[model samples]
Target: MADEKGENPVTVMVVDDHPMWRDGVSRDLEAAGFTVSATAEGVESARRRAAAVQPAVVLMDMNLPDGNGADATTAVLEVSPKSKVLVLSASAERDDVLDAVKAGASGYLVKSASVAELLEAVRATFDGQAVFTPGLAGLVLGEYRRMSTAPADDRAPELPRLTDRETEVLRLVAKGLSAKQIATRLSLSHRTVENHVQATLRKLQLANRVELTRYAIEQGLE
Candidate 1:
């Protein structure tokens, strides 16, 4: 059932400066059927291991040695385009959250999340959706709305915008369907599903599937 819905186990990278936290995260994900492809502490190690493993998603900490997690997000994304970074921090500060998003994080989650919530977030991230914990989603959307209303600054032209088909694809994405699974459900080929995903990303100006998920939620697409 899970595989059919594209809920198959995902490959993940866990990055935290705390050893116990890392171990706990790894254990939780593993128990939930995901493979912990790699584990790293601090900035340099996270960057190096993320490049090496190229996992589908990265669980990152906001504070790290050598650099901030936001900084690490940029480096990891550069090396692994398929990977989405989700900030797991103790902070609920708007500055910290916005900083991580600006640095290319797909989502920001407070460390208070339950194992179930973490599992869902990781799966959602894998499925091309951003999965922020409860309160943070509003913060992100409010920021985007504010930015949209801001004076014409140097920001790039608005993204192309999602087509009707693309919107449907995104809805399915939120349901945790992989490209292949989504294709089967929609009676399209896997390549077509991939194309739709890529188009959605382009339209939303998201770096990866994780941000795409968040965008869908913010826009009430799903």
Candidate 2:
């Protein structure tokens, strides 16, 4: 399970009000070579246990008994900044998806996903990719693009000044280019492309590639 530092077999915490769902998710993750750090039924318990364990990923249900999962995501991240929250909810509502993203969730997956899909989403979220249920990624990105026309204050802050290279990388990212593709297009190494992306994320305080793409669109970089 765990390495010498007890960190191997990535740690996961399951937060859902339904006992059956929670237990099943935990079981699946454990079987997939993850350490089930903790399980909780609602926001407060999730927050407390998450702070204590600081799991690498959190599988959260949107409609918790005590509060919405978005709020719980915010609270949990406040305590465990490195933990990625992936919403596993029944709702695929646009507002729900947007809210989770704005609250800093790393991904959103509706309950209709197959076990394999869910597992893949968990891995993607842990790897800092922004996973979304089918059709939902376009919805979120479109909403951000629409918001580009709003008043300046209505949008997120302008990214801290980026170098010309960083800006170019960001534009490519917004255009849906992968790191490898961007590297080849720009005549840069893949590692260099990834470095620029991370720098952009840090400067803009964005969580993942999805948010970075949203920012690029909002800034008219795409």
Worst 10 residues of 1 by lDDT: 1-10
Q: For residues 81-112, could you state the per-residue lDDT of candidate 2 as single tens digits?
A: 98989999999998888888788887789999
List where candidate 2 sits over 4 angstroms from the true fold.
1-7, 152-178, 181-192, 195-222
Residue pairs with clashing backbones, model 1: 128-209, 129-213, 130-213, 130-214
Report how far residue 135 has shifted in candidate 1, in Å: 2.1
TM-score of 2: 0.78
So what's the TM-score on candidate 1?
0.69
User: What tens digits encode model 1's per-residue C-alpha lDDT throughout 1-222?
Assistant: 033267655789998889998998898888888889999898888878888989888999988878888888988988887788888899888778778877878777899888788888777666555556666655655666666665678565665667889989987765445688889999999999999998888766777665566565445444
The most accurate candidate by lDDT is: 2
